[model samples]
Target chain A: MKIITVKKIENAVAQLAREANLFLRKDVLTALKKSYRLEKNKRSKLFLKAIIDNAVYARKEKLAICQDTGLPLVFIELGQDVRILGDFKQAVIKGIALGYRKGNFRESIVSDPLLRGKPVYQGAVIHMDIVKGSKIKITVMPKGFGCENKSQLKMFLPTVGIGEIKKFIIEAVKTAGPDACPPYVVGVGIGGTADYASLLAKKALLKRIKLQRGLSPACPPKQQWREGTVSGLERELLLQINKLNIGPMGLGGKTTALAVNIEAYPTHIAGLPVAVNISCHALRSATAVL
Target chain B: MPYAAQQQYCRDCPSDGKIMKILNAPIQEKYIRELKAGDEVTLSGTIYTVRDQAHKRLIQDIGRGKELPFDTKGAVIYYCGPAKAPKGRVIGSCGPTTSSRMDEFTPLLLKKELKAMIGKGRRSKEVIAAIKKYKAVYFLAPAGCGALISKYIKKAETVAYPDLGPEQILKLEVKGFPLIVGIDSQGGSIYDKD
Candidate 1:
């Protein structure tokens, strides 16, 4: 058995929050660079270039990538053999608040949803899972509302077809239009209960966008998947979304979406729940294992 | 200015061999009329920063006939909320927020002679109509490029509603701020013509 202190977890969360907000993930950055190189529209090209430059500037200057430093979401993979030394929940919430304060990130969480009270940073939405190894992995994703507000979910009949699902996903992006920044990383969650599916979709955004074909030299060769698998669906959906031509910032071009990531789980025979979560080009997340 | 000479005004763009115009803020109605949808331009001058909460307060104040913190006539409003400035910095990452959230209050502000708005996303049909009626313009800053955009903001100072936290209004002095004309005075928009 391995032991981990809550203080260590807290400190790790704090660091992860700052890093996630300040630095664009490597895979995301590479995708943006590739998009910039291939973008045909002059306006789209300029916007992509600005995005790339912004990431670089944010990293070098240690500044938040966007003012909407976002609501901090903590995802933890805890090994079953690892026993924590302190109150895990409090440690995470404290860590998030401390990190936001330390980084000067915006306090975006409103105390009350309907009455609309003061925005505070004392809480975080945390998801924890137990795995086999002794190591603990923590990932922080700063979900900006611009795209989060555009996320959609539909509980389809068990009899529905793949085309219907595809249509629903595309329509979600269409409705998002220029509102949520485009060149989006689309996350699709399939085959779970309604709430669980939404969570899965949100989690899918953390998947690194693997470049296909000649998009990026640094990206490893594309992984192979069976014709009926989730990976194959992801590739097909990506192609269809880019065809929307929403482009960078929705100015209209062939590079509407950078990547589409899907995560699926076995579900009851009664319903098929699919959720789509769109993230802007500033797909920010940081992960560390200890 | 001759078209050729106007094209020479800024060398940072026109990479596609297109003309990129430069506009100074507190922009005149006539100048706004000359801008067409999809025109790439660089903006310079003073603008006010506002977000959802600030807009709510502004509209409420207008309803109560209370004095506004800044002049609305010919003033430019950017839908943005900046991060707290780090040490030795003028301001932290500041970028345009989605404009549609403010669609409810936009027409009234347009009626108040607000000349332009800077934000990402499409405006409502009513807001677009108001733009035509008032001859105002809607510009889009590159979304999610906050760190790069902050470089153009030479100064930022909170002007009102300090208790609103990040959503407080700020007065910003900007130079060479990049923008694309999303909707022009004639009701034409980059999103669609019809």
Candidate 2:
């Protein structure tokens, strides 16, 4: 029975959009540093150094880390108990338009994909969900075009099995090579329909950059996993993916992928759908709770 | 057996100075399939800008044998879709969109004598083969280095496909634009060797 004003959402989105572009999240940065140390290829090591330097410069000058600035993808977790007081969509779009203008981020959205048309809107994509909660949560993930362009999804026969899934992921990464910008995060969505699986794959990427800083209450203690028993499937997948040696920027090194995240949903008996979404180290996303 | 020594042989290349001028204003066509592995050249001229959607349309147009909006001979095309310019600024944060997406269209363009390309990322085998056949070269500008690249562009004007917005075909005049050799006429790729 709580009324939330659209204006609050607008302001929150604007602030989040600007912040996400200018700053690299702490978890992503930490992971990058760790990868930098473990990288074996000299060229990749140098490349990682340059990436780190660019991040530092971007932060100091309050500029975007990459030119694409990405589309403003807004994930909304709306409380069923709350009603919006005004035009929520318009307010959010307005905020995004204004934020891009102020932040000096690029307007990469076009109105239509065919006939080479004009840009009717400023933001790229916005996703929303209403869930059972008393508080509203909004997350902004501004994904650059390089990694976004490399995302791939395909549905296989129900009997394709896990081995096929692994092959698909490896092929996708190999095809992506240095283009997706390496030292990247790979999110794999297994099960569900083709479209839903792809969406989940992208959603899994929105999980905050993994951290080594301290214990996460959301995750079981590390030793518990070491003892084996949890979803050992995901842990094993993580180990295999990191061993690919695609390395940073595909120059060949120790860490091609920073982490591999997987999410699953029950699917129809006819098919097994898989989608892989790659995210660079920038991992720029912010959430606001209302 | 040091890594530095291993890199030395890969980095050495012969530099040939053959300058090509892009004249007749916008939409110059240059064949890229004929260039070699280690040639150097000063590119003087006008180049058109397009990325993603434009490439898709170009492929479709070629498939349909429809007359494209511009000529393709001896042309140096730059892969970029710039932001809307503010007042008094020639262009906004203009940078190279990843070039791999354009791979499917590049060989088609090379057949028509499209000579040079400027972009980032590794080109596909089709593109490299076309470059070798047409004697064209691919140039790589630094990725994510838009702010620096914008300084080299002296003037910008929309030439064709105005409706494409940022992906519109625009004639740009650039000076001293820095780029590294990507694919040479000999079918050699710098991305793989480097």
Candidate 3:
């Protein structure tokens, strides 16, 4: 068994927390630039330009791309053979606290949802998965409220069918409009339980934009098949979404959505759960393997 | 079919167009009611900061008839909760948060003689009603352009609720702060018309 020191995890979390806020991932940037070229509306075109310029400025200044430098969402893949030397949770929290403080990232986590109280927690959200390997993989995603507030989750009957799913996705985007900070990425999860579906939708967002070895990293390899075939479904959904003409900032343009990713799992015969998680262009997340 | 005076004025005006001046500023809210949509104004003054949590607390205090920690009358309120600043900087990527979340508390604040609000997105009907009733206006600074906006804020100091951390209310002194009119006192909204 391999022992990973808690200190290493702490340091990695802190550094990654800061880096994710300051830099736009290469995949996100490339997608945005592509949208900029393809967008037909003049107003949305200008808005997209400003977004790209903001990305550049944020990088040059080493500052957050947006003020709402969201809560620290840590996704951990723990290898079964590995053992942590110390308290893993505390180490991760410490890293998030230190990173946020040093980087000047905002503390968006509030102690209470209602009654308006102080912030009790430093990090935003942490999701962990235990795997077969001894190495631990940490993924940090700083999700701002703009896109987060627009997220929607619903459980439908098995008979609802694809037309209903398409309608739901479009309506979700329409209701969100400019509020989610348009020119966004939409992640859809089909099947699974309601809660599991919501999670799968979020994880679908972490899939890199680039094609790796002629296969989309956003979807699992065919050999490791899940309950249903979501890869083809995802590609079709992405094309339909872009046709919405929501544009940048919902100004009525061709580049409303950059990509749509779908993840699925087997569900009970009675239920067909679907979830949609929207993310803005910033799409800030980091991955570290130990 | 123009009146004599109007005819002369129309003839003198250029048919192509007139350049609209775009005023930019560090994010801050201060006396925004005095401004109107399509009116260009360069801002330089003191503005306070707050967001959903801060607004909720402030409104709750008002409901209890308790004194607020700061004087809000005739003040501009910026809808923001910036990231922490790097070493030696006044603030970090200080940009606007969404405006709609604070829509519930705005009318109450307006009753206190608050003048202006700065943020992005559409306000609720209650907020629009308050703007029309109280003659207050809302402005939009480009969202996601935090780093660029931070360059204009000359100084920032925490005024209250420091324990709120980033959500802490701050009193910021700004110079040449830039913005575009979003909601006018006449009940006109850019989001509505555009």
Candidate 4:
């Protein structure tokens, strides 16, 4: 059995938080650049340029990319054969608090939802999964509220077709319009229970966007999931969403969305649950494994 | 320098033959009246920043008839709550937040002669009506461009509500701050047209 210490986890989470806030992921950057190249609207091109430049400056200056450093969400994949040495939850909360303080990231979390007290950097939304091997992987995504507020969930009758699901996803993006800062990276979760679907949608945002048509990393070499499976659906949705003309900041352009990432799981025979989670251009997350 | 003479030939201006205008804050109504929706402009001089909490506090103060932290007459307010500055920087990544969140408190501030608001996203119809009623303008700073926008902010100091942390009201001196006119004084909106 591999023994993992809480101190190691704490350090990793802290560094990941800081890195995620300061650096725009390369996949997101590549997608943005491609959109800039393809964008026909002059105003949208300018906005895209500014966004790209902002990422550069943020990295150079070691600054938060956007003011809303967001609520820290830590996703953990734990190996069944690994045992943690110390208080795991406390370590994560402490790590996030320490990182936010040291990195000058804005603590966007409030103590209570309704009461809404002063912002605190105490806790993070943690999602953990038990896996096969003896390794611990952590990914920190600081989800900005501007897009997170626009997330939606729908419970569809099991008899419905793909057309209805597509419409619902399209409507969610439309309702988001310019409010959530398009061109968005749209994450869709279909199947599972309601809450699980929401979680799956959020997790879908972490997928690496495929810039070209090829095998996706999520699938095995023999599977060819990119052209034959859900990835085909992703491509179709991407085309439909960009047609909405809700371009960068909803100013109207050809690139309304950079990518559509979908995750699916088995659900009850009588229900079909769908959730949409939208992410802004500065899609920031960092991952580390030990 | 002449107000309109400093035009930089903005590439992002609306396709309506409107020349990019360079204006200073404490903006006059006449200058605002000259702007049309989709016009690209750069602002210089002082502008105040306020976000959700500050808006609520400002409204409460307005309700209680207390003196405001800064003069509101003919002033341009930016809807932003900036990140805390790191060492040696004047301010951190300061950029506009979603403007619609401030809709509830905007009309009362407009009644105090708030000339303009700078933010991202669409505004409520009530706020749009209020903007037209007050002949106020709404400007759009590029969303999600905080670090780039911070370069324009030469100075930033918290002016009120220190307890609110990043949500504190900030008085910022900006130079050549880029913006696009989202809604003009005459009920013209870039959002509607485009």
Candidate 5:
């Protein structure tokens, strides 16, 4: 049995938060480069250039890539054989506060949602899972409010088919439009309960955009799942979404979405649930294994 | 120079039949008429920053016949909630927030003589109508371009609503803030026509 201390985990997370906010992932950068090569519209090209430049400026100065430093969504992949020595949640929160303070990032969270507003950006949302290995892997993805606001969830009858799902995804993208900061990466979660469906969609977003076409790394419970993996659905949705005129920043162009990722789980005989979680161009995340 | 002010300083800059102007806050009607969609401009002088919560409060004050915290006439209201300013910097990574979130509160603000808005994303139809009715303009800054946009702010001081944290109303001194005029007083919108 391997025992990991909480302090080591916190230190790693603090660094993760700083790094994620500082740099755009390599795969995402590649996707942006591809879009730049393919785009024909002058305005769209100009906007894409600015985005590319912004990434450079953010890294060189160690400044945040965007003002909305975003909420820290922590996903931990734990090994069943490993044991943590301290309070996992508290350690993560402490790491976030430390990282944000040192990183010169903004704290956007509020203590009260319906009442007074606070700019406290230090809080984090964490999701942990146990896997087969003994290694602890943590990924911190800072989710901006603009993209988070545009997520959609709808439940359909079991008779509903792929055509309907495709339609719903397109409509959601259109509805999200400029608000979600298009040139987006859409994560579609199908099956499972309403809540799990949404969670599954968000999980799909945590995967790198380049790896989405093949076997998704983070699959739901292997036992209860029966539906053929929807990598095909992912490709179909990607084709449809890019066809929409909502180009970079919804200003009209060919490169509206960077990728589409879908995750599915087995559900009740009478139910079919779907969720879409859209992520902005600055897909901020940093991972560390302990 | 504030990035916006640098753009504003190029008042006489014209290229390919496109006329560019450098404008200041508290803008006048004649200048508003001269401006058209797709024109490039740099805004300088004083601009107020307001997000959804502060906007709702302003609307409420108008209903109660209370004086606004800042004069609205000829003002440019920027919709943004900037990151916390690091030590020695005038402001942090301050970029425009989504303007549509403030749409319902906008017509009321526009009626009070707000000449222009600095934000990212498209405004609603009601907002476009009000921009035409009030002869105001809307500008777009590239979304996710926060670090670059921060260069436009020369200084920032919260004028009111300190309790709102990032949503606080800041009076910013900006110069040559680069922007493509997205909407004009005539109701022409860059997004709408395209």
Candidate 6:
């Protein structure tokens, strides 16, 4: 069994925060490049180029891809076989503090939702899960409020048809419009408890766009989407979303969405819940396993 | 689904397409009226910064009949709350935030003779109508490309509500600050382009 120090988690988080903000993930990069090559509207093409160039400059200059380096959404997959150390929660918080200061990432969090005082990026949105491995894995998704504000969850009767889900997803993306920095990567979560469904949606975003052939058929469907296969509903939703043509900035175009990723969980017999999590083109994310 | 692609507005556009004519703030209505949606331009001169919190305070100040920290006439308000500069940089990644978040305050600000706005995302109908009524324009600063933008800024100083931290009002001296006309004096919106 691995004896990973709490200090290691702290240090990993600090570096993850900086790296997440500064770098664009490869999956997103590939999608954007493909979109840029295929983009017809000259205006949309120019927008795509700027997105590409901005990534380049961000890497070269060692600056955040966006001013809103965002409140950290820290996901920790702790190994059940690994031995842990000090106060884990405090270590995560302190690491965020160190990262915000050292990385010069913006503190976008407010003191309270209603009170709205000074920024409080010192704290993080930490999600922990226990896994079978001997090493801990950490992922940092810097979530800017602009897109997060647009995410939504809808609870439907178990009798709800896929058509209703499609409509809800379309409405969500349309309502987001230019506001979510169009040409978004939409994460869809279906069939879980309300809160858990939204979590599933966000988790779905961590998976790369399903540009490769549908999920591998040889692999068994172990829940948590280890198989990478797209259900019929997921494929249909992706097709319909791109048809919205909300385009790059909602200024309009064909490339309204880069990709749609869906994850599902078992739900109560009477409930059907759907959640959508939208991420802008900056899609700043990074992960590390120790 | 068969689809014919619709066009989105261009911001952070090509430097080669049109020779950018610069506008210095305290912008003139005539200059604003001459602008139309989709035209790219670079702004130079002084611009005032405000975000949701500062905008609320400024509106409150107006209602209270107290003086605003900066004059509203012929003014351009930039919707941003920039990160502090690292060593040797004039400003940090200073890109625009979503403009629609300030929609409620915008029409009121425009009524006070605010001439223009610079931010990303679309504005509300009330704000667009006010831009028309006031003969002003709305410009879209590219979203998420702040570091490249900081180079255009020559100076930045906190001008009001320092207590708000990043939400503090800033008076920035900028040079060739690129933007696209997202909405024009006639209420023509770039978001509506085909």
The numbered model that scores best in TM-score is 1
RMSD of each candidate relative to the true structure: 2.5, 6.8, 6.4, 3.2, 4.9, 5.9
Which portions of model 4 show Cα errors greater than 4 Å? A213-229, B9-19
TM-score (C-alpha) between model 1 and the true structure: 0.95
lDDT value, candidate 6, whole model: 0.81
Q: Write the per-residue lDDT of candidate 3 for residues A99-139, one digit (tens) a residue.
A: 87777776677756774456533655778898998899998
Model 1 per-residue lDDT at A239: 72
- Indicate the docking level reached by candidate 2: incorrect
lDDT against the true structure, per candidate, is 0.87, 0.69, 0.75, 0.87, 0.82, 0.81
Among all windows of 10 consecutive residues in model 4 chain B, the one with the lowest summed lDDT is B9-18
lDDT of 4 at A196: 97
True-vs-predicted CA distance for residue A83, candidate 1, Å? 1.9
**What stretches of model 6 exceed 4 Å from their correct place?**
A212-231, B1-12
Q: Which pairs of residues have clashing backbones in candidate 1?
A: none
Docking model 5 quality class: medium
> Against the true two-chain complex, what DockQ does each candidate achieve?
0.68, 0.20, 0.37, 0.60, 0.50, 0.51
lDDT by residue for model 3 (B34-66), tens? 456634334567889988778978999999999
The best candidate by lDDT is 1
Q: Residues B32-77, candidate 2, lDDT per residue (tens digit)?
A: 3333442332343577887877877877898999988778877788
Cα distance off (Å), candidate 6, residue A113: 2.0
Q: Give the backbone clash total of model 4.
A: 0
Please provide, for model 4 over B1-194, each residue's C-alpha lDDT reduced to its tens digit, 9 standing for 90 to 100.
65667676544333223456898998999888888998789888899999898999999999999999999999999988888888998888877888999998999999999999999999999899999999999999888988778888999987988888778888999987888899999888888844
Residue-level lDDT of model 1, residues A1-290, one tens digit each, is 99999999899999999999998999999888888888888778877887888899999998999988888889999999998998999998988998999998888888778977768788788999999989999999999999999999999999998899999999999999989988888999998899999999999999878876674212233466555678777777777788887888888887888888899999989999999999988999999997
**Candidate 1 lDDT score at position A272:** 97
Docking category of candidate 1: medium
Estimate, for each residue in A1-290, the C-alpha lDDT of model 4 and write its tens digit.
Answer: 99999999898899999999999999999888878787888878777887888899899998899988888899999999999999999999999998888898776788888987788888789999999999998999999999999999999999998889999999999988898878899999999999999999999999998776332212233333465368777877787788888889778887788888999999999999999999988888999998
lDDT value for candidate 3?
A: 0.75
